[model samples]
Target: MFPNEWLWRNKLIALLVLVIVIELVLFLVPWERF
Candidate 1:
């Protein structure tokens, strides 16, 4: 099979971005104010 460098790079970048977004929303976002 031929190597696909562009596709691999895009997939990895997408995954990294997804993880960063999830972490920010779950750990950094404040919903309750007292």
Candidate 2:
């Protein structure tokens, strides 16, 4: 119920979303030159 706890949860969710987006871009891109 604390505000700090709520903020921390939001931060974690944002981090997870960012990671997923990065993974998707990497998978979708066809950069075989690496």
Candidate 3:
């Protein structure tokens, strides 16, 4: 049970980081063509 909880937390953190990186990329790059 402890291992499962730890994995879940890691997954959540990874997802959050991925979202932040995506947001940063969008902010830095111009999307006028899209």
Candidate 4:
């Protein structure tokens, strides 16, 4: 595969992981303390 395509795919995966992490943190943490 081309380097550009690989880079794009890596970026997308990284973004998805980041979003999942944020969602998990929000879901696990208590909201009433804020």
Candidate 5:
């Protein structure tokens, strides 16, 4: 695989993981305290 392609793929995977984490946090935390 090309280096640039590998880098982009890694970035996409990282972004997805971050989104999932944020979603989980929002779902588990109470909204009234904010």
Candidate 6:
């Protein structure tokens, strides 16, 4: 609920982004048929 806490949260954001990328590359996108 605090903006300052979020603003200083670099590791959380990096982990979030890494998780999103892994999901997209491993489980979501069907890149083989293209």
lDDT of each: 0.87, 0.95, 0.94, 0.96, 0.97, 0.84
Residues 1-34 of candidate 1 have per-residue lDDT tens digits of 6469988998999999999999998887776752
Single out the weakest 10-residue window by summed lDDT for candidate 6. 1-10
Question: lDDT at 16 for candidate 3?
Answer: 100
Against the true structure, whose TM-score is highest? Answer: 4
> What's the CA error at residue 28 for candidate 2, in Å?
0.3
Q: Give me the runs in candidate 6 sitting further than 4 Å from their true place.
A: 1-8, 28-34
Q: Across residues 6-28, which tens digit of lDDT does each residue of candidate 2 receive? A: 99999999999999999999999
User: What is candidate 4's lDDT per residue for 1-34, written digit by digit as tens?
Assistant: 5799899999999999999999999999999989
Q: Which of 1 and 6 is the better model by TM-score?
A: 1
Count of clashes in candidate 5:
0
Between the candidate structures 1 and 4, which one is better when assessed by lDDT?
A: 4
What local lDDT does model 4 show for residue 30? 100
Per-residue lDDT tens digits for candidate 6, residues 1-34, read 7788776797789989999999888777777887
The clash tally of candidate 3 reads: 0
Ranking of candidates on TM-score, top first: 4, 5, 2, 3, 1, 6
**How many times do residue backbones clash in model 6?**
0
Residues 1-34, model 3: lDDT tens digits: 5788899999999999999999999998888968
Model 4 / residue 34 / CA error / Å: 1.2
Candidate structures ordered by lDDT, highest first? 5, 4, 2, 3, 1, 6
Which clashing pairs does model 5 show?
none
Off by over 4 Å in 4: none
- Residue clash pairs of candidate 6: none
lDDT of 3: 0.94
After superposition of all CA atoms, the RMSD between model 4 and the true structure is 1.8
